[model samples]
Target: MHNEPLAYRMRPRTIDEVVGQKDVIGPSTALYKMIKSGHVPSMLLYGDPGIGKTSIAHAIAGTSNLPFIALNATTSGKKDVESVVTEARMTGKVLLFLDEIHRFNKLQQDALLPHVESGSIVLIGATTENPFHDVNPAIRSRCGEIKQLKRLTQDDIIELLEKALSDEKRGLGREKIRITKEQVARIAEGTNGDARKALTMLESIVIASDEEDGEYLVDDAIIEQMIKRVGVFGDKRGSHFFNLLSALQKSVRGSDVNAAMYYLAHLLENGDLTAVTRRLLVMAYEDIGLANPAVGGHVLAACQSADRLGLPEARIPLAQAVAEMCLSEKSNSAYRAIDAATAAINKGQVGDIPAHLRDTHYAGSAELGHGGYKYPHDTPIGSFGGWADQDYLPKELKKAEFYKPVVAGEEKKFAGIYEKLKDFRKK
Candidate 1:
């Protein structure tokens, strides 16, 4: 245990010592109440990486005074599980902690059903994925209660790191390293509220700190060296990922090229090429609209290149698309047009398709008066910008205007013809 990394050695042994996730293991929490009362049923703990799923399992065993047996689903086989079952049977009571329980295939997971159902082994299953989607149905059924641990807050991470700094038994108290609150907060925020990350980062810094003449100093320069390990969370699904994507788009719309590129680089660094491609595609059509319609094609080509090449090399086309998107004249006319049209329909303004606009290809369409489309190509005045006086909108929506272009890029040219058409219709 003394040879263990600071994070592993400092794993919370008692419920009271565990930091954050109060919503899951607080004194008033149901899971806590159950464990304290010696009612240790099978439980599936689910959440992000570095959350307290494993520590909570240890706490459960400590509170119950039950024998603790740890196994990782990633490596433990059916024989290993059977060994645990035998130990539980022999001892009469054991709390079995299975880390990454979702990694257990159906057969391996099914092996524990009998032991867990018999009450000989109290199962504590931990998984980062959603249990319903990953764990076998039988195992998940037995683990009826699922306690979800949330990402640690920045304050929670800071407090845990501070305790590690002072605790001698399992932490760096003997080393006597000094870290400012701002420095601690910097590590905490950079870790995205992951306690293990924050603790490990602190440990790395302390190990690498060097004595200058008499005392060891940990300054911004050293911190920078250690924090190179702190990286963007590369999750494809999560609020954090979407938040970054939203920031990238808004930066483009706001014409902040640097900010847009920064976010683009962050996602790319995290191996989110697929998500970047999809988001850039949406941004091209929704945010750039009529301002630079051709940018839509460029964005598509970038997406294609990203899909074909993947990362580092793919970032070239993605960066090109991002630069163009940020530099191009911006408009949301197409997006607004759809929204306005939808609003009109929702408000009961929808009417039957005009007879002339209805299908005319069927054999009897002409007899049903659905073949009289204006054929604007043959208009007497001209084709483009012609037929200015036509009322093609549904009767109730004839006077409604859904697309109003901003005076930018291609939309500026379209705006001229649109205004003229509107005036002609009014006359």
Candidate 2:
């Protein structure tokens, strides 16, 4: 009823009241089933800002009838974690919710593992970062992860606006503000599907237009003015950083070398050399692997050189590296190969390594016939008579070759070598 931001006022008090994230909260979903059965595990909720990661955690805390404690990883440390654990020991079961858990360094994350493992605290961690890349493996392993998606569609934003406007306690329905569908759509489009931004903008319009008149009406002009004043970057700070990076990555993935270079330059202009260098290094491996292995080495060298040189001098090497990577014969063969191999291993086809390839360096190794293997170079055609025919590749993937080289620059040479090797194997 009081003057407060719509986003805060409309915060869902119950799981059923929460908007969007049906994938996680839908009937028969893992979290839904867990909450229903009172068997919720320590969880790591990851997503973009304003996607209800914290709301879900809060809903769980409230509904589960357990003691809930919140900690901000940016401010809290090992001492705070230990204190929470101590409190939980005496208070029965408690949920320790950590926001921005990625900010916690390895030591701080390690401190929480013991308590989570012992069930002294049910850890609910929220991170805007990708857990696969940011969270330590030990901490990630101990918690069930729920990935919340970004609000991508206009319909999703509208749903949120509807929820905000209809709720009497939180929305502007009490002020007799009348907003048309067009105004809602305009606000949603301007906010780029961010529910919090949309709601906040709507609240601002309501407050600014609240008059002694019969009714306050929202139009496109008001929405556009607010957008320009607030700027498209929105209240959520990290959006610009991620949005720019996403554009840069998509440019590379699309093979628009010119576009990629431009994005790289934009980041550099903004003094994001470190971020540019790191992404280029990752792109070298993740997007431009094996098809051009030299790209990765070149990227690493560029990064090291930049560290030594710093700034203006570093920008040259960074530019060279990014341009070279963009212009190189791009292929994700290595990425595919590893993913396929990992999938096979997960399916439990992790057979032993070939005996001949096993260790033969230790003393008394000859007694076990470790060094008894024939050398490939000693044979004709530089091979040990098809001795490399061991089943290193899984049976299911015997013919499932992941690395199909594109006929581009150096990749053409690799293709030729592969052909020659196959011919030799057949012989």
Q: Could you tell me which residue pairs clash in candidate 1? A: none
**Per-residue lDDT of 231-264 in model 1, one digit per residue for the tens?**
7654766545676899999999999999999999
Error of 2 at 271 (Å): 6.3
TM-score of candidate 1 to 2 decimals: 0.70
C-alpha RMSD between model 2 and the true structure: 9.6
Q: Point to the candidate with the largest TM-score.
A: 1
What would the TM-scores of all predictions be? 0.70, 0.61
Q: For each candidate, what is the lDDT?
A: 0.83, 0.74
Global Cα lDDT for candidate 1: 0.83
